[model samples]
Target: MNLRPLRPTDLARLVELNDAAYPAVPITPPEEMTALLGQADFTFGVVDETDSLLGFLIGLRPGADYASENYRYFDSRGADFLYVDRIVIDATVRGAGLGRMLYDAVFALARDEARAEIDCEVNLDPPNPQSLAFHDRLGFRRVGEQETKNGTVTVALLAALL
Candidate 1:
């Protein structure tokens, strides 16, 4: 399998993968995704030789950030750090180790950028337990928790020193 930046042609496939992985949670809409892609700081997807997208990772330049609860989380790591907006893998490809592939690519990006840390939040809904476990398995430690619009509590944050 080959890993690459998300292309305009892959947007619809990404939408499908994200929606399938995050059924209860609404995935990012195409318009918002387009704006995000234009930022040039986001890592897009992991695809195979046939160009089938397996998963994706999206993040932003980190700084003083806010949780869903409006609580502030600060990182002194400076401009190099990235705050992951979301990560999703296609269900059909779940057991194939693509998630780790996507993550390692993001980690490599962080290192190449001279980043100090990688951060992200995981939703607390029971159905999303795999995310929490996945992050834990990746060496991220929990920092805190917060609640979202639907009263779904989200584990506030998790970070790994890169």
Candidate 2:
């Protein structure tokens, strides 16, 4: 397997993987993903030896004063944090461990970037109970809850010191 920053050529595949995993997710248009890929702080994909993308993760480097903002249940009382914006794997590969691989890759990126913490949110839709458990297994603890545009309540915000 190979991991790399998202490239323009990977946008459609990336979006497709994301959509397949979370069909109800409100993704930015392909054009927007293309633009966002070039930004300095966002790190994006994971592909296998044949160059097929299995999943992708997007993270942001939160600034110093970013702590004071309300992140629901996430503990952001520290100086630095990497917020996981999204992570999705192709549904066909659901049992293949791609999700964990993608997350491990993102965590490496955060540590390399010297982020003091890592935080992410999981929507509480009925079909996504596994997400809450996954984060828990990875050592993230619930800090609080919030709502999203889809009207689904989030179970809680989760974070772990990197």
Candidate 3:
């Protein structure tokens, strides 16, 4: 497998992978994905030897022109950080180390950019135990929590120092 920058042409497959992940992440429209790509500090795809996208990650830096409540969780804290807006791996490769490879790249960027931490959130309302466990192993702690989408969803604010 190899990691590379995500491009517009990859959106259909990327969105499919993202949607398959479900409320683990909200389903995003292509137009919104385009907008996020514009504001992203980093966006990358993990692909196999055949160049099939296996997963992707989108991260945003502080001060980005983004309106995501998850991003704001860190902003409200006055933290200097890189926020992982979303990450999705194809079900076909879920247990592999691809997620780690994607995160390692983002962590390196956070360090290189002198970010204080890497921030993100995991579902709490519907409960994504595997996701929360993954974040725990990565040293992310619950810094805070919030209910969004009219309280239909609750997220655990998480961060790991760079």
Clashes of each: 2, 2, 0
In model 1, which range of ten residues has the least summed lDDT?
Answer: 63-72
Candidate no. 3 TM-score: 0.97
Each candidate's TM vs. the true structure?
A: 0.82, 0.80, 0.97
lDDT of 1 by residue, 1-162 (tens): 778888999888877877776643457688866766666367768888888888887666754333423223524433346777778887788868887888888888889889877787776653567877888899887766666666755454678787
The per-model lDDT (C-alpha) reads: 0.71, 0.67, 0.89
lDDT string, candidate 2, 12-122, tens digits = 897777666653344567876665565426665778888888878876665522221233234345547777767877777766777788788778877898877788877
Q: For this target, which candidate reaches the highest TM-score against the unseen true structure?
A: 3
For 1-162, candidate 3 gives per-residue lDDT tens digits of 999999889988977888899989988888877888888879889999999999999998778778887797788788998899999999888889888889999998888889899999999998999999998998999999999888899999999987
Q: By how many angstroms RMSD does model 3 differ from the true structure?
A: 0.9
The list of candidate 1 runs beyond 4 A from truth reads 23-25, 63-80
lDDT of 1: 0.71
